[model samples]
Target: MGNGHGLVTLLLGAILMGASSFVQGNSSKHVVCYQGTWSVYRPGLGKFGVEDIDPFLCTHLIYAFLGIEETGQLRVIDAYLDLEDNSGRGNIKSFNALKLKNPVLKTLVAVGGWNEGSKKFSVVARDPLKRAKFVDDVVRFLQRHGFDGLDLDWEYPNQRHSLENEDRSNYITFLKELKEGLEPFSFMLSAAVGSAQFSAELSYDIPAIVPYLDLINVMAYDLHGPWDEVVGINAPLYAAAGDASDSTGRMQQLNVDAIVKYWLLAGAPPEKLVVGVPFYGRTFTLTTPDGNQPGSPHIGKGIAGKYSREPGVLGYNELCELMQQEEWTQKWESAQQVPYAFRQRQWVGYEDTRSLSLKAQYVMDHHLGGIMIWSLESDDFRGTCGQQRYPLLHEINRVLFGANTPTGLTQESSDDKPSEGFRCPAGAPEGYVRDPDDCTKFYYCSGGNTHSFNCPVGLNFDLSTKSCDYSSSVKC
Candidate 1:
């Protein structure tokens, strides 16, 4: 329903931190950030490159999902991007290059994602020779690419994708082999495990694998989404009253509290359990106009966003942009501790600064290792929604490390900075200025510099608060 992210983060595991602090691997707490490299393909505001990352925010940066061959070899999903060309633009090198700016950051590459599926991985895991080659390939691939570790993002091992984990016991056995191969290089080994009990029981012998894993990233979000017949929050902190206890405890198991408890009781140590915090929201097209609340029926996924261009999900940047509109009404659900907004039939349940900060506090209270953001790319890196660029991430950072700052948080990248490439015109000294070259763009001049922006499609650039409008509404 979403871009690969709909199930991807859940597939890899989940969201936040704004303002970079030196949250290193050995630090008292963990802040794991997964970068969906696919974001590079997104145009305009949605484009997020490694250079866009705030190096100081996370201790661990996992470059999401390198592909795996059926015969048990690592494959670069985008060799054109990951590998260095004659032109020397390699995403892998640039991704790992962030460590130069932040020496404390531990960069890792993940293999397997929702799209990669389980069949290839499951088959490889069951074959000893194939598994050994896979382990060796992972080690060599990481070392060659200069990654500090490998994140085993198998989605769920035993779930019948109809491919992965058919043998059931192959996952633990595969991990044993992977551990041996990785240990020699001192590479950190982590896994993105399922959250709810149903998947947990089906996928893991957690105790057996915990011994080999340095971090067990709980894919704690995505408990419910468009797939469900009824509406639900993307990542509810606590079970809502409406989430009445069912005979199977499906509702109870869907929240963060229950998911964490299940993992702890199942034998994961508090330090090893890194909780997932989702950065994006799941959207739905309500079956009825008034059916905006959670548990309501839906016709299908909500309309795709202006950016991200995915039907069933909206990136935080897209969500915030919608919130700026007059028709969209955002409301908080006290029970779930997350927010949902709707304009007509479109509804989405998503996280905010308050929810993320509370989740950080929850991690501390529960004695969990740290909070892992589903991604760094989805946050409002453009600072389009006011506040700092990554308001949600910043709230968690401020709460977790007391990283206090006013005005600009740090020397942010001008790659997507507001009015980055434009300049103030002589006639218009400040405020919104028309682009000299193109009518489809404008600049917001402030603080003696031009803060430029592109006018939304089919709209003429104008000097108004609305930013852009149809040709008939205003004079260009």
Candidate 2:
């Protein structure tokens, strides 16, 4: 009787565990992070390779920039870098190998980017035979490389440098064909789409394209850049008061809220819309430092980033370093729910944990599918900036998957006191604790208790500093 009772208890426990897992899986938000293949060649930026990714952090990891050949065949941008056996270091094998860590993590190949150009896509998508061949080729390529699916990033369907007018309708047809082809294999189909009103209207028939797609990853960033005549936020959550102007055309509807609303209003299902969050910032050289607000005069691009090596752009890692400079001042725009930095003649618009937190909340409140990050390599994966490794991704996970926090880690409260009956074992390493009242002020963990410290206003804690300091002063 005792043995029978024990067996019954074990069976009940196992059933409960399985049910808990099911509930967790159903509630978790889909985090799709793009991994740029070209980032492997950027030397100064920690030379990020596929091996650097933390597969457990994201639900889907999309390998970016698989070019479309003129003949409508899918081709890797660099065969040598992607496929060559670098003693188990090759991009393709290394990326797929991430499944060893998290078997459920999905990997997809992203075809086309800003530089890949849309000519090939437009040419092939316009012809039925070519489109069929392209669809088959994409499936074969993904299967051959062990990819879970494909992400089409054609920039725009019917815009400058691409086929005009018919391209938009043809795009829907192409997606339908691609979905039909991949249906047998149960593969996922997603697309990276433009968020600007003009581009969205010209590029996609939202209602028609919806049935064929698993998710619509909106490119919410780049709404404003150096190309614009006036400065603007990189990815504003909301539009500011009196910010409306038909003169700038689509620029007026550049915020995330407007983009999401447009798609929803245009018949996109809430669960299929994945809002994008940029892991980088747009930079501008201020024409006059006195008036640093958006639309301030700017003559040229801001100082080029050392690692990104791009004028008017800076990755989160670079931005974190730049914030260390005493001259740089970080300011938040309540209306936009985004932050910007300025120093001397330079100004930058970018997202941080606070802004990203709000965005995540917005996603949850609106019943959206999930969040998509432009490029994972731009993130401070190495924990050099101090908050935590993959801080942006971590915050998203906390907000979206708080019920199942990874590794059994629980979020610490702002109360500055350890939880009841909690005690750290002896010999734990000292670390920085976040202050709830102020993000710039952090507490140091020593002797199992936290001691509070404040960083100068506009400056944040640097892990290297062991104290609050200017962004430029930290050697991240």
Candidate 3:
């Protein structure tokens, strides 16, 4: 669990890189977002579609939940919506067509999700021929669908309905084979990894797996939910001191910083690891209304929203609406950099502009590749809350990309303009701008414009101080 060695090495690398002028050169940081195919079915949620996505906001957009067939071949979970030519409304076609708007956007198909389970992946990974066929079928499927690559979201590799022990090493072999097969076609291969320490340690051979991956998206959210007997934050950036409901000591590690550090210590490259952020919140109903802090007693799932319609869950859009109610009060957890809202006996743990800004800053300070949002449909894309559409995502862009304008908007309205001669650029390739005052501090350039962000506390912008030092060493 110790990250001392990795932390030192990472900082050393950053220092060496800082000595070179190339460190200031433009190098794009990925903004990868997952779009749930099922969201289109939720009519109450405005039936979000691929067209609602702003291709400019994401460098890579993953269309999620492709399943594994019983025959071990990759299957489109929704055949009608994915391949129906008559309607010309296929999700695949519509999603890929976004390239016409922004050629730089790369579309990927994410196979498997929490609901799909791991049985198929276990069967395919254990059998060499089956694995080959699965890889071959997926490559062809992606090609036919005009997708840029494949993202293997097995949910997990060696736990919960999977071959727990052997699946760990077998996963590495399977990825190697898949990568080799995809190399001929130049398809990108990535995986969605579990964040819990036990599962993460047992499920991945980090060193071996990193070599075959173009990106490794850590599912840092869902650390706590209704599944837990006690109420907790959905995706805390750090563990608060009072949480002790879980005896396994795992509760302390259920946060973004711990999860990312675990991967780094396990040999995953920082640049290849993209931290995942949830666009939704985990809701819970309080058993005792007076005591509503995290780890307090909770009876069951919170009431479902009119749009999300699922108990114990609310999308960012729904949460925004809930915020408008006078009864709901919001509180920020500074240690975790997350927020929770309570109204009467209902509570929901979610992220907002303030917390997300801190998360984005973490990504930059830690020298991680970038941020990945769980699903796009959960965001308020219609500007309904008196804010610009996709406000949460826009905050991410503002911090990570220096984008002054909202994702889909070409320019801010004259009334909202920052200054007379400063029109924000529509979009620009991701890169870094040097800070004149400090080499350890820099501005991340995304949609175009520079937003100042600093390195972890005590760390400077100089090449030597680009990566984070040990927490004990830094004031942060």
Candidate 4:
């Protein structure tokens, strides 16, 4: 979803995100990891599986994209890989089993990503019986599979893929009904939303639906890439002055700052907002080596990563391997608080550990809920960069949580865990307020007095539900 454009490679499937690594945080912030299930097929180093994942790196892990048919019934995108029935691999159970490693983790199944399109969802939402049946079927599927919730990666409602605009209202009805149905099971609901102002405006009535979601994960990357005329920051923190002069004329608002601001202005509460970050780079082949700046013209397709082998994209690990060599020169774009590198003809823009740290602070500064990663396997899980594995994610967690976050990504020890001591706020309302430093702790208020408490070991505080619940079942 981050690569909203029709990049030949990123357009392949349900725009997905994932998490893996050994580090766990009591972070009150959300670490949503989306995994592209097909990465398991990546020839060698790129091949990843649920067992390769670390349960603690993310608070919630999403299995992207189960499919939905025209009739509103759900289907597995890859039964041979996802189910165990009929001698299948049973990835559904393997993905959910990450919770056994970190019981507080939330596992969710996503339906209808970019490739899945909007027609089937629109058709279902428009029909009362179909919508109800779909919701019922989804809940049963989740229960049978032991998932904590469902993520709607519907791409959009009322988008061009759909024939009618009634999708906007119908989506609200669907959410309302889905909420009522899931409430009995305490299953949290989330949606992967587009970040562009034009698409978001067309796709959702943000205010009307915010009340129904636990987290609103904005696919905030892909602001610029090979789809555009120049070498632009893939997820620029701020639009540069020269960007406005671009041929497409989208430069002014095609940035992370503007996208998040638009969502806030559109009535999405700060706490429910989880900004998306890419662990990969938008790569392109430069038309001229000398013109290597952000606006440099490009040939529109860069060399594929040795691992991902996707023409227009490179995983962070692939980019890092290139940067490790003396020939590749990396530069920092201070104007955008981002990083990009050029190795002769190939120019790529992507987020690094430093940029992600800045983004972590950005999330807290804006009082936004947390950060969402595009996929689990793209990060340097193999430690090929000669650093600890999953450095980008670990950096974000350290900054978002506290200075003393666990350093071990593979093993947990009682020694590194710190205790929270957040003071109760004065003149607070009579309810529960989760600790900003600890996902497991909450401060309860009654008659202007407060007492701090912790969620059961396997759960986290759900601000939306006003109680402690499973990570997948709670809204941050």
Instruction: Output the number of the lDDT-best candidate.
Output: 4
* Candidate 4: segments with Cα more than 4 A from true spot: 1-26, 244-249, 403-410, 414-476
Model 1, 1-476: lDDT tens digits are: 11221122112111111112222122357788999998888988889998788876777899987989989988888888788866646898888766444334677899998888888888898889999889889877876777878999987687857765354588888888898888876778998888998888888888888998999999888887889998888999999897775776688889999899999999999999999988899999999989888888997788676767889888888888877864787889899888888888889999988888889889978878988888888899889888788887778766666652111123332112444356665565324456766766554443354443444335565455333455666576
Superposed on all Cα atoms, the candidates' RMSDs to the truth, in angstroms, are 14.1, 13.3, 10.8, 11.5
Q: Candidate 4 overall Cα lDDT vs. reference?
A: 0.77
TM-score of 2: 0.79
Give me candidate 4's TM-score against the actual structure. Answer: 0.80
User: Over 4 Å off in model 3, which ranges?
Assistant: 1-27, 86-88, 244-247, 404-476
The estimated TM-scores of all candidates read 0.79, 0.79, 0.79, 0.80
What TM-score does candidate 1 get on C-alpha atoms?
0.79
RMSD of 2: 13.3
lDDT of 4 by residue, 1-476 (tens): 11111122111111111111112333457889999998898877878898778766777899988988767788888999999989999998889755433434678899878888878888888998888788888888887887878898887889856366799898889899988888777677999998989778888899999999999999989888898888888888787877667686567678788889999999999999999999999998999999899989998889898878889898998888877764888899998889998988889899999999888889988989999999888999888889987888788778776522221222342112223545556776544577787776665443454444455456666676555556776656
Give the residue spans of candidate 2 off by over 4 A: 1-28, 85-89, 245-249, 403-476
